[model samples]
Every structure is written in structure tokens, then in C-alpha cells.
Target: MNSAVFYSSKTDMWATPQDFFDALDAEFHFTLDACAVKENAKCEAYYTPEQDGLDQPWTGRVWCNPPYGRNVGQWVKKAHDTASGGGFVVMLLPARTDTRWFHDYIYGKTEVRFIKGRLKFGSCQNAAPFPSMVVIFGGEHKNE
Candidate 1:
């Protein structure tokens, strides 16, 4: 596998593994897919890229597997804001513990579950290059 494909792909979208999503859905009963395209949406009430989830209202058990790009900080901030307002949000994100977003938004504010092994995301033939973690913001299982 070319390391470049994993490091610098043209798009940042990485479809979440179905099994992983199912497990979380069973626990959270997610009401919306906060970030998805039509094809890979995990929930019936999903916001496509056109809807720009960053600008939308998240009012329930929301699942966010956002594009792991430059704007990921925005997504985390939104989740934090929504949770502060009593919404439940669960985010599947890279275990980038060193980043500014990790320290600023997730360090002490959310429940983070680091996966033991790399996940084979969607139909991709190889496992993801980076480790993953699930960050929960408000819910029965919230950090607080």
C-alpha cells in the first residue's frame, strides 16, 4: 500500500465500519447522522455535505464521523456546544491526542474510548493508518 494514499488522500471522508457503528447505535439509539453523504449515511435523518452539519442544529443522539480534515476542530467545538446545551453527540475520530482540538475540546470535556486495534473502515482493503477513538459528549455514558 502506498503510504501517500493514507496520508494525503484527495478527500477526507472515511466511511465508518458498519459493525462499529451498529454497536454504538445500539447503545446511543442515534437520531441523526451529523455528517454523511447519501450513500454512507448511517441514520435515516442524516445531513449531507450540502447541508453543512457545522451550521445545523443537533438536537438528539447525534452520530458524527466528520471528514478528518482541517475543519475537524470546528466539528468538535460544535459537539461541545451542543452537549453544553443538553444534546448528545458521539464522534468517531482519529486518536490524534497531540492536536490542539484534542487538548482544547476533548481532553477533559468528553468520554474518549480508544480502539484497541486499527479499524478497517468501510470497503477499504487495508486498516486505517491511524488509531481511532470514540468521543462522547453527553448521554447516559457521558464523562460527567
Candidate 2:
């Protein structure tokens, strides 16, 4: 367990499982990156908070991978709005189950996949000592 913690923290990026990515690929049918979302996937749009700014344009099929921190509410809210606006929002983050974001943003609105075990981050020390989840909402062609 300690080894897991040590690895995750160093890697600020929470590593997602292959199954999670596969599930997303199955639906979107496009090659996904930690950053951009290309239109070539037959996908219309892709949005990542890591980009310019939150206020930037959000059009077509959108994908958001926001920074997860203590104040993750903003990210959660944005993802919810994106989904409500007829866009697909797939989130990968620590399963801070006790937080309000877990209840409001994760609990009922999307499909949640709890990873079976701890994972090693690319080169990061394990700041996250526990399992993570992949929360997927909306659909490829689902309308708001």
C-alpha cells in the first residue's frame, strides 16, 4: 500500500486503467490522448481544462479532464454542465467518496468504474494511496 502511495503522488497525473480507456474507445471509436480530442475520431469536439482557460469555447462533442485538487467542485460543475448541454464528459480522478462532488457529480449522473486495485503512476510518487474511479457521462450521440 505504501509503495502505491509513493508512486502516485510523484505522478501528478492519476493513471487510468486500460479497461476504462477501452470503454471510452469503444463508445467514441477514436484514439484519445491525455490532452486533446481530435475530430478524426468521428468525434465532433474535445475539451480539456488543461487547455487555455475554462471560459474558452465548448462546441460539438466535448471531453473534459480537469485538474483534481481539494477544490474539485469547479471541475465537477463544469463536467456536469457539459453533459447537461448534450456533450459527453468522462472524468478520471481519485475516488474521494466523502466529498460533495462524489454525491452530486458522480453518484447518480454517470457510470462509475471503481478500479480493482492500486496502480503505479508513470514516474510520480504515490500521493494517492487509494483506488480511483472513471466517471463517464452523456453519450456519443445522446442529446441533452
Candidate 3:
């Protein structure tokens, strides 16, 4: 497995500002400006280097919009590990069907909330229509 830092940019770690984070900013009690590019952006929290912050075990509701970079598989795996260890992990990930992460970690473990369209990312807010999925894991497992 690759290091968590590989998933983020060296210059700017944050990628997309999550929608869920924006909806309930007060509840999280954190600021989005310093971490992410946009302010009051309706999104979940962006992924940081595990060395920097993601290492700790997070309890309760958790949000993660992992960086879409070289070693994204590692981050996705980490999210799955977080979910498995009794932590709520909500992730906004690109629908990369061919990747190993999609097959092993995501495919059969959880129910995916498929987005109707592509999400607008940071900076240019590019309209990426490559299909995305919101994988909710270890939150409320009433069905199972």
C-alpha cells in the first residue's frame, strides 16, 4: 500500500470542497477556507495526508473527499479501513471501475449513492462528467 500523502498535492493538499461539509458547517465546528480553496463550498471535508492528520481514529459522523491523484487507491483503502473499524466514512470518489480499489474495497462492502452528474471541483470548478459515487460506510447499518 502507498503512503497516504501520495493522494494529495504537495503545493496544495485539498482538492474538492465537499457538499456535506458546507451544509452542516456549524455542526463540524471547523473552517473550510484554510484547508480548501473555496469558502462556504457545499461539500465534505477534503482528504489530508495521513501523516498530517488522517492517522487518528475518527468516531461519530465522518466525511472524506479524498484527493484524486496518483495513488488514490491507497486513500480509498484507508477509507474502507476506517469504515471497517467502526467509524463512519462517507467518501466522494471518482467512479474508476477498472481500479483495484473499486473491486476489492468498494464493490460489495457498501451501498453506493450514485450521483446524477459530475461534480464541480476546485479552482476552475471543472464540470467532470465521468460519473461519481458517494460510498457511505459504517454509519447506520440498519439494513444489515
Candidate 4:
């Protein structure tokens, strides 16, 4: 892994591992990727950076591996809002439980699966610096 690429502020994109995505796809049958570039998009219907997924109306089962940055809170918020409106969204996010977004939007509102270990995102040979979690929203009613 290139240290520069790992540390760069502009490089927030982390492609989801195919096998992991496949397993989720088998269960969720995701119909859209809420955030993706052309090369890494898991579904035919996807929102690119230029499209600003946050502004789009999410429908059906959605896969969201949003940019991991200061703005990640916004993505989490969007997911929660979409789910509240009857959309299903599965998010891949860093397990930062201390964050306000985690408490505000996720705590009692969704089903969370904490990954046991760091993920080796994209083609990187090394695991991510932080642990990851799969947060599922809108499959069933939960106290907000």
C-alpha cells in the first residue's frame, strides 16, 4: 500500500470487497449503489460523485459505502432519513461509536454488525487502519 495514498485527504474512496458484497447482495438483492464510481459500482443504477447521492431519492435496497471523511456524518444522516421514509439502506462504515452521527442516527434506529477485523478495501494488500461495521436500516420498525 502506498503511504501517500492511504494518508491523502482527497482519497476517501474504498472499494468494497467483492466476496463480501456478493454475500450481502445475495441477501439484500441490492437494486442501487448510493455511492460509487463507474469502476466500482455494484449495481446498474448508481450515483456518482457528480450526481451527489445525498440529493437523490433512494429507493428499494441500497448499498452505500460513502466517502470516509469529515462529511461522513451527512451520509449517515441521509441513510437514516431515507430509511425512515421506507427505503432500505445498508451502509459500510468505520466503527466510530463515539461520533455524534453514530449516536444520533444509528444507536437504537438500526441493526448493526460489527466486523471482527479491519477490512482490506479495494486492491490494497493491507487492512484498513480502523475497524468496520455493517449498519442496516429500514428492514423493520425500530425505536428511533
Candidate 5:
């Protein structure tokens, strides 16, 4: 297999697995999908690529499955910053714990749950090449 394509896909975005998202939504009651397209959006309120979620202020409980690539660090930093400003953010990310973003934002800064095995994201017949993890910044949502 070509390692380049494996690490950096033609499309950085990966659709979040439904069953996984359903479980998290049940727990967090997410108010916004911080990064999503129209068809696969997990919430009624979402930010599309055109909307540039990074430029917007995240509010309430947020769900983010950001595009995976070099820019992922920006997303992780945004999640941490949003939480620091009092918003709860949950992210579905590759379990690339050695990456700079993991050390910079996730290490000792958030709650992480590593998945047992690879995930079959979207309609892909095969499981993802990489492992996955759920990272939560801040606590459970409050009705504030």
C-alpha cells in the first residue's frame, strides 16, 4: 500500500461513523457539529467547509470530526481553546498519540477514550487504516 495516501488522503475529511456518533450524542447532546457537510451532518446546527468553522465561536456542546491532515493541529487547538472559554467540545480523532497536536492539546488537557479496534467510517467497506479515539474537552454539558 502507498504510505503517502494512507497518511494523507486525497480527501482529508472522513464521515463520522453513525453508531459512534449516536452514542456520543446520547451522552453529550451536542448542540453543533463544528465541522460537517450537509449530507452527513450529525446535528441540525453545523458548520460547513464554506462556513469556515475555525473562524466561528463554538458554543454549547460541540461535536467535531475535523479533516485529518497537517491542519488537524489547528482544530485540536481550537477545541482546547473553546473549552477553556467554557464550551464543551468532543472530537473523534485518529489515535496518533505521537503527533504534536496530541502532546500540545490532548495530553493532560482532555479526556481520551481509545477505541478497541479500527472503525469503518461512512460507507467504506473496509475498516480505517488507523486507530481512533474520542477526546473530550471540558465536562458534561450543563443547561446554562
Candidate 6:
């Protein structure tokens, strides 16, 4: 079976590559992972699904790679609100610029970095079908 089919049948949770996380960590010094399971957490402090990351206090520099399913809007909204409250949040999101959440929360409020190519998430040998982006909120406005 192909990687895409394998992944699709198995899980929607795409673990972020450690090297990618390390590169971002060098700059952001992320203190909390707003969304993560124990096995995939990039930070010492993290919120698992059961913890409902959206309801948690997002203090300091937070790294969020929310689930790519239907509820992504909530996560994006939470990130925006947290940033407005003075916390910094960095998010890894699918580059779906056409989505409502993108226009509503990310367009004017954050600095966006569109990744050059699809990423090989986790241990998958094939690259992600969709492109990805990194968005920063509540930091010094580099895009503005």
C-alpha cells in the first residue's frame, strides 16, 4: 500500500518532524505545546486532546499544530485570542489560504511563512499532499 493510503487509513495525527521543530525552537524558544500527545510533544509542557488545549491557558511562547480536521477553526481562534491577551503563539497549519479560518484569524493578525514545498511529516517517507505554513501571532510584527 502507498504512504498516502497508509496514513489516511491509520491516523490524521501528523507528527511534526523533530528537525523542523528544532529549527523553529532556535528562534521562538517555545515554552508550551498547545496541542500534543505525550509521544509527539515537542515541549516539556503540553496539552493533550483530553486536556482540551483550546481551554488551557496559553502563556509565554506557545507552539501549536492543531488537528487538521473540522475543528481547526476553534484552535485558530483560540490562538488569535491568546495572542491578543499578550501571549506569543506559533502555529503550523496547512496552507489553505482559501479557508474561512485563514481569512478571519490569520490574514491581518499574523506573520505568515509559506513553506516552499510539502513536508514529510513524522516517519512518512512521502511528502504531505498539501502544502504547509507557519504563522506567528503576538510577536514583534515582522510581516506588518
Measured on C-alpha atoms, candidate 2 has an lDDT of 0.55
| Local distance difference test, candidate 6 | 0.86
| Residue 90 displacement in candidate 3 (angstroms) | 0.1
Where does candidate 3 stray beyond 4 Å? 1-14, 17-51, 123-125, 139-144
Question: What is candidate 4's lDDT per residue for 1-144, written digit by digit as tens?
Answer: 343453333488788888999988887889899998887889999999899999999987899999998899999999999988888899999999999999999999899999998888877778888899999988663322
| Candidate 5 Cα errors over 4 Å, as ranges | 1-9, 140-144
- Comparing 2 and 5 by lDDT, which wins? 5
lDDT of each: 0.87, 0.55, 0.57, 0.88, 0.87, 0.86
lDDT by residue (1-144, candidate 1, tens digit) is 332343234568888889999999887889899998777889999998899999999977899999998999999999998998988899999999999999998999889999999988867877889899999998575322
Pairs of residues at least 3 apart in sequence or in different chains that clash in candidate 3: 18-42, 18-43, 18-44, 19-42, 19-43, 19-44, 21-43
lDDT of 2 by residue, 7-92 (tens): 24443435444455556657555322323323211233444434542555454445444445564566677767777888666666
Clashes of each: 0, 15, 7, 0, 0, 0
The candidate that achieves the highest lDDT relative to the unseen native structure:
4
> Candidate 4 — worst ten consecutive residues by lDDT sum?
1-10
Evaluated at residue 3, the lDDT of candidate 6 is 40
- lDDT value for candidate 4? 0.88
Report the Cα lDDT for residue 48, model 1: 85
Model 1 segments more than 4 A misplaced: 1-8, 142-144
Query: Could you give candidate 5's per-residue lDDT for residues 28-95 as a string of tens digits?
Result: 88989999888778999999989999998899789999998789999999999999888899999999
Candidate 4: count the clashes.
0
TM-score of each: 0.90, 0.63, 0.64, 0.90, 0.90, 0.90
Off by over 4 Å in 2: 1-12, 15-23, 30-50, 60-63, 124-128, 139-144
Candidate 2 lDDT at 50 equals: 48
Name the better of 1 and 2 by TM-score: 1
Q: What are the per-residue Cα lDDT tens digits for candidate 3 across 8-117?
A: 33422334544544643444443222112234223344323433324555554555665566666776777788778886666677888788889989898887878777
Instruction: State in Å the error of residue 76, model 2.
Output: 1.6
